[model samples]
Target: MKVGVLVLAFILAFFAESLPLGPLYAQLHPDFVALLILYWALSSSQVLSYFGIWLIGLVQDLVLGDLPGSQAISLVLMLALLYGWISRVRHLPSWEQLFFVFFLLLAQCLSAWLWHAWVGPIRWHSSLLLGPALGAALWPLLTYLLDQLQKHWPRRKTP
Candidate 1:
């Protein structure tokens, strides 16, 4: 049942992440799949863990037509960063959460940029830069929606 819920979430993220915004928007776009996965993974024990994150990231890499494990590494980094912050913060409101999401968008973009620099130049990649900016702007609404999903569907624990 947990696996089924995660699969559903991944499907949703794929669509959310694949939205064909203008060329300028792709780079800055928040990784909905990653974001959702992280949010649920952190908030719910039923959701995927580090291993699941890696698998999703690898799928994302394939979806974007990049080498495998790029997103896996990025997911690892994002998870680590999230865990670090979770330990420090308490009673975070919507605004602060939005800020954190935005910050993470930038981190994802930076990871992609470095991948390009190290591996080879990926042409026509500027939109991803804009993605974080726009993604930040959209964070509040997205988080709200996801939170609601959590509340409504609320994955059931199975032992």
Candidate 2:
């Protein structure tokens, strides 16, 4: 069932991105999958690893038509930070649980900005920050839903 959850997560990410954006503007383009990936990496490191993060980031890069390694590196760093913090917590709260994801999303945005820094004439659109901010803001909802799913779903029996 872990595999099933991973597959579902990827599918959600795929469809979330596959949809068309509106003509108005996109400074707030949310990284739906990245948030989900970070949540699981922090909460369930045994399930989502650096390789998993990199793989999903690669898929996101391909689908979004961005540089191949940017998201991969972004995700790896996010997971590593989360993992380090998680190991240090002996009595972590659900709120604290969500906070790490929020932090990672922010880092990803900063990373994205830094990536664009190398490229000339950066848009410097204040709106670009919206995506990660919104992603971080949505962490509580995402965490609740994920918790419910894990609680109700019957996972495969471990050996």
Candidate 3:
């Protein structure tokens, strides 16, 4: 049931991201999938491993029609970073956690930009910063909602 909810949330976020919201809005739109992946990595790393993140990235790449492994690689890197620091982060206050999440989002955005620059045109824009900023802004609301959903999830029986 937890897995189902996570997958459903990811799919919804993917579609929400793909919505047409004019040129500027689209450019400034946050990477909801990436943010959710980070949240899961922090909140439920045991359940959502690097392999799951890679698969999510691949799905995202397919949906966005990008280079095959681009998002997969980026997400894997994000997962790796989260895995290394998750223990320390778990004990932080909400404000500190938000600060850390912002950096994570920044790193993900930077990696995606670098990957795109390597494979395509050398375009640089302020919108890259906007993505992470928006992601951090939304983190608190997302965390609360997901926490509520998790709390209400049916528990598994012990054998």
Clashing pairs in 3: none
Per-residue lDDT tens digits for candidate 2, residues 106-125, read 78877866776776457676
Instruction: Give the better candidate number (2 or 3) by lDDT.
Output: 3
Steric collisions counted per model: 8, 0, 0
User: What TM-score number comes out for model 3?
Assistant: 0.89
Q: Which stretches of candidate 3 lie over 4 Å from their true place?
A: 45-47, 154-159
Give candidate 3's total backbone clashes.
0
Best by TM-score: 3
lDDT of each: 0.68, 0.70, 0.81
* lDDT by residue (tens digit), candidate 1, 29-119: 5677766754664456453467867888888887777776777877777776777776443247656676776677668767756776778
Q: Report the lDDT tens digits of candidate 3 across residue range 49-84.
A: 678788888998888787788788888887778778
| Candidate that beats the other on lDDT, 1 or 2, i.e. the better one | 2
If both were scored by TM-score, which would come out higher, candidate 1 or candidate 2?
2
Cand. 2 TM to true fold = 0.81
Report how far off residue 25 is in candidate 1 (Å).
4.7
Q: Which stretches of candidate 1 lie over 4 Å from their true place?
A: 1-5, 19-25, 45-48, 122-126, 154-159
Ranking by TM-score: 3, 2, 1
